[model samples]
Target: MSQAKDQEMSMPSSRQESDRTAAPSNTKSLTLNSTRSGVGTGNFGGYGMTNGAEKPSVLHMIMEALGLRNQAQNREPTSKDIGTLIMLGVMFLLFVISVTGFFVMWFTEYYNNTMLENLILAENSDTAKSWLNPDPKYDTLLKAHIFDYPNIDDYLAGRADKIKVVDIGPLTYQEHTVKDEVSFNKNFTVSFRDRKSYKFLPEKSSIGEDYVVRVPNVPLISAAGPVKRMKPLERLFVSPWIKQFQEPLFKELTVSEYLWGYEDKIIKLKSLGRGRRRFGLLMSRNGTSVDSVQLNTGEDDITKFSIITQFNGMPQLDYWEGDECNRIDGSEPSMFSPHLLQDRSTVNVFLQVLCRKVPLHFEKESSLQKSSEPVLLSEHGTVLAQRSDQRHQVLRGCAHFSLVPALLHWRSGAVQRL
Candidate 1:
């Protein structure tokens, strides 16, 4: 036992002194060796000279470790070495192919994008054609329901018999809109004057032109507004004309005479810039454009597509005392940006006639049978008109005017943008 113990002690201490230094035989070992060599580039390198000896590349060293290469003079290769060489050659070819494939994919996408950008909004492009002549399928029918007072005699005489009122038949009209003097601006906007002429749809109407309903005297009430604001001398000078007008508090006429045009004694005196002396409810505002609109073309930003950037070269109007009420917001009724609908729940709209701007709150989501996408139904609740018993509400202390309630529907799916 003692002899065995002596032999173990004199065995050259295999734990420390007898331990042999190892040479790299794989990628991991080679990487570690290169890191310790201090001449390697980055974390795993073979780029610089160390101790006056050139270091081979990671690929070369790997081949040597695999017994497929010789650093010194070449020897007759074995079958195993030939197999390894073939494998290494295949790996190198695969690497080259991978790099080439990635580069080709990137280049193809870039080229396609460039082509798409150049083709956008060209004179012959689909976008320009659609803008010039909108699709008939997208046209929305505009119909109105006029509220009539059946017991105006009792209501005016302070008789509160529930203030009986009824809604008349649907008045159907076709909009023939024309956008003229279109100018493509350099600032990625298009300026154009918009006007809309109406075509009465007698066939679609439930009530004919001869149908009459008793309602408030629109012209007399309109004249009374100016009379209240006039000075005493101005009122006195206008008193004779007012007496000659002979327009009573209420007047009876057919639907055609009220809506189209009717001769009036006072119309000629008030129309300084008007072409016709006759007056109608809808005739004066039809196809009338006193301003231009600047719309974004979505050339640079897709979110601003078809949005009204400016109206009459101004972002807001001076017609109202409320800042929020006068500010112009939202896109055209036909077109809106797909990106904008992602996170928004409420939609804003610019109304030309009644209220300038209003919020359309979301009500519910529904799917149409013809469309694959779901749409959100929104509406402007009668928060203004419902507050008082008066038929008309003052516009931010500006003037007394009535508003027609309307609803808006928008699709949730990604709409194709220009």
Candidate 2:
């Protein structure tokens, strides 16, 4: 009986050993198949079975309930999610646009307010053209005529032999309207040696009509019409006589070189006679009156007085020809003279002659100079001409005179009519 019981237990042990050996073979086969079929190399729980490695979580339950509990899964965005994303992109674009518009408006306002002042307060705003009122007839044309016959010759001959004169001092400016144009005139007095005096009056002419520019606090309207008539001698004449001859027969004094000397002297003109000489005095025009200096001597001879007038004249012909100083720069040295007090602003007068210059060609330019460098020409008003006082004794002959252009031109032929 004991032998029969031992055989039964031994049979049960042999069956359990066979089962453990077969279980490993089946697990190996399943794992190989799962890898080929794109399944994860993890234990998938059977129906109502549990896995040792995995635990049941909320995400798994939710995915399982939604029928998406797969190792390889896909999810598409819903219409609601797409709409929300589009709304965010549109808001970002609108924010950029609003910022850009804000800066544009600020810049426009700043330009119109501040930049407008520069144009309105400018000293000169002469624009030669206007889009609003454009007329080809109003344009100035400088034409070169053939200078053939009676036309130009007659015009020059018949023109008045006079110069434009202005007397500048304490002036009274008057504004008036003339022929739909805004015009201005200044009135002043003229006295000859304090003997005879007359009130010199100028005719009103147009103003403020130079350009078509408009700015804040500035007048919009401008003058538009024919240029004012010129004086007889003021017109620039180029005769055929110039082309026929190699050069002009007689030398003419240009307006710029008209104010020549400090003392009284005659300057031969272009006329046929002894070519008149300018004596006494001449000076650059000061408005209507020629700039003159007066010395009031209290009955003492000016030759004996120590207070002499120091006058500076234009650069001389010798310096212009070729001088060492002239080679340094293109500027010529001015001449100075000290003489007894005279009634005229200039101490002497000079005659103009034709000149030629030989240019100096340098291989290389010198170093640039600063603008504050010293110049040869001195300042105009070094000393003023004042009446003598008790502190200083002066000659009685120191008299100041403001002569008419006619008196200077007729006596000395010193008038430059412009």
Candidate 3:
């Protein structure tokens, strides 16, 4: 019985060993067949092909399906690594687009605000043209107009006699009214000088005039009508910001015909020769009284002078002397000796006048009422003849002088007037 039992145990042990060995062999065969099939069909997952190792976990299976793991060998991608790579690619693409858009927007805004607007204005209107030009006629006219009074001899000598006239057509209508308002404050420096010698007056000479004109803050208005008649308030509506400088940096001098008299009586003729000249005249009102006085004359001197001119304020002639018995020839305008009027207030105006001849000196002493001492009123220069009343008046006239149109025509290569 012992022998039989021992035999049975031995048989059982052999069978167990055979089973283990056969299991391994079968697994290897299956793996080989699966790999071959997978290679041919490119379907490793479907064929249940695995390397000779433990089967992959859920994580490993997912990696293998996504091509991150090798089917021939057990391999898998980490969850953290895969997620980070996908995020990096998406962020990089977004960054590239964002950076490109920023530069485009910046350049677009710059061009629109500066270059584009100026180009449009220049193409459409002559008024938008630049101040600098090469033509001599235009150059002279522009300088004269802008600077108030240009030396006619100097300008004429530089160019031909002919003059050109420019035609400024009707004003254009605007679609919208300006709503923005601008405010500014500025201080100007005014120096006094002698009208005759063109010399600056001493600070203690009581010849200088200091004026502060305050322009209010306002909105811009349309410039559709005659610019001369346009109100400052309306102008503010069209251009909210006030231009600190409208005229030239240097003072402009302009001259005009001057008519002399108090109210109604005709007086003796006075010729305004080149430089300053003085004339003695005698006059009587209705034969009631005779008065004798010396008159300081200029090119634009007229017989019947009106003391109360309504341009700015009514400026009264402070002094006038006339002689009664002097029967001067009306046909031949009488001329007097030239003398220098030092530190004259209206010298700038005299310098700017457009006339055949300008006065260089005068015997009469013309001055402003207020004196700061050493700085005489005439020391700064003369006021422009056209703008003389304007300085004291509240009305703000259009600075666009008639000279501008003429200048533009000259600059446009047109023939001279004369």
Top-lDDT candidate index: 1
Whole-model lDDT values for every prediction: 0.63, 0.29, 0.30
Against the true structure, candidate 1 reaches a TM-score of: 0.59
Model 1, span 1-418: residue lDDT tens:
9999998998876655434433224656877787776745342243334455545656566666875676563345567766778888899999999999999999998986675454344344676667666665554455756556566566457563334556666878777666678888787888887676666788888787777767556666667667868999999998787778677665666677777667765677787547667867765446645667777777887656667778777887766655765777666665565544555656666655543655666656666667655457466664334444432334542221333222112234312221
| Model 1 C-alpha lDDT versus the unseen true structure | 0.63
Summarize candidate 3's per-residue lDDT along 1-418 as a digit string, tens digits: 9999999889989999999989999998888886676863345455365445354577666566667667666445667747855676699889988888888888888965454333221222331233111122221110101111223333346664443332221111111111111111121111111111011223322222121111111111112223337688866653332233232222211111110112211111112234223211111111111111112212122221111121112122211121211112111111121111223322211111121112232335434445523222232123235354433332223121112222222345434332
Minimal lDDT window, size 10, model 3: 188-197
Separate clash counts for every candidate: 0, 21, 72
lDDT of 2 at 339: 30
lDDT by residue for model 2 over 6-96, one digit each (tens)? 9997998999999999999999999889765545444454323234454655545545555545534434445654565557669989999
Instruction: Kindly report the root-mean-square deviation of model 1 from the true structure over all alpha carbons.
Output: 20.4
RMSD of each: 20.4, 27.4, 28.1
Ranking by lDDT: 1, 3, 2
lDDT for residue 122 in candidate 3, whole number 0-100: 27
Q: Which segments of model 3 are wrong by more than 4 Å? A: 1-76, 106-120, 123-418
Query: By TM-score, highest first, what's the ranking?
Result: 1, 2, 3
Candidate with top TM-score is 1
